[model samples]
Target: MEGILIFAPFFLIPYIMAHIFNRVNYSNRWMTYIFSGIVNLAYSVLFDFISSYLKEDKSQPVCHFPLFLFPIFFSPFLILLQFMFNKAIIKSVKYKRNDSQNEQ
Candidate 1:
């Protein structure tokens, strides 16, 4: 019960952080990818880091720095991966729109 409560929002990180600044249908897509990745990495890791510090019992049976380090170093890659997925979704939608236009 408690476990689910703690972990559920982790699943929605992308949708929450990824959509805020994305330039859907923008021309310069590389910037979109780079900025989106940067924001997601910063948003996720920074939020977790700050929240951990805010907790009453900061020690949760582990060394916090190492845990923080993992996300700090790894989040960029994950964010970029998320960006790619977003781009793919956008591309598919654009394709569908074009198909519908052609049919009309």
Candidate 2:
């Protein structure tokens, strides 16, 4: 739908970026968390701005500002998920190497 089209990037990009960063084993998990949160907030604000501009409405939605804070919840969760993801990737790579060495 139209709503999904507008909001998908706000939710999706940070998740994907976090996952990618995790795979690379980034040292600063907190920085990544904050970066993702800010990105999410910016995207959400942009979505609201675009919607309001298209609708030609001067009235600001009450939920918009509150919604910006939603990223706070995701920040910690994203950091944990990234940590897990990095561990998994490291394990998988080690397992693959071990298996290859065993065959040779």
Candidate 3:
């Protein structure tokens, strides 16, 4: 339960970032992908740093692998998720606009 709680942001943040990036720069798909990847990488590094800092014991294992490597392992998946999310958001907005225009 605690582990799930700790890792929830790894999945959620990318979706949120995708929505934000799509809103901010809907014209450029590549830019949205690049920016979302950068943001997720930064977030992974920051999360590792904070978790390490908050640990009370230096010797006990908090994670199976090195904390610094967490981003490397997870970044690709996060970026892919962001890409998919951005595409979905763009499609939804396009449909919404079309619907509204047709109604007018």
lDDT of each: 0.51, 0.58, 0.65
For candidate 2, write residues 1-104 as lDDT tens digits: 75685556545655566565655534554455566666777776777666656875558653456445545555566566555544543333333345766777
lDDT of 3 by residue, 1-104 (tens): 54664466567876776666655644665676566556656665676778777888999866635545555677787678777777777544343345766777
Q: List the residue pairs that clash in candidate 3.
A: none
Clashes of each: 0, 0, 0
Query: Tens digits of per-residue lDDT for model 1 on 17-92?
Result: 3454355544544454465445545555665666677779845753446434544565565566657656554343
Worst 10 residues of 2 by lDDT: 88-97
Q: Under the 3 Å rule for N, CA and C atoms, how many clashes does model 2 have?
A: 0
Supply candidate 1's per-residue lDDT for 8: 43
Instruction: Estimate the overall C-alpha local distance difference test score of candidate 1.
Output: 0.51
Using all chains and alpha carbons, the TM-scores for the candidates as numbered come to 0.42, 0.51, 0.59
Q: What are the runs in model 3 whose C-alpha is more than 4 Å off? A: 58-65, 92-104
Error of 3 at 68 (Å): 2.4
C-alpha lDDT (0 to 100) for residue 101 of candidate 2: 62
How close to the true structure is residue 25 of candidate 2, measured as C-alpha lDDT? 36
Off by over 4 Å in 1: 1-26, 58-64, 71-80, 92-104
C-alpha RMSD for every candidate: 6.8, 6.0, 6.0
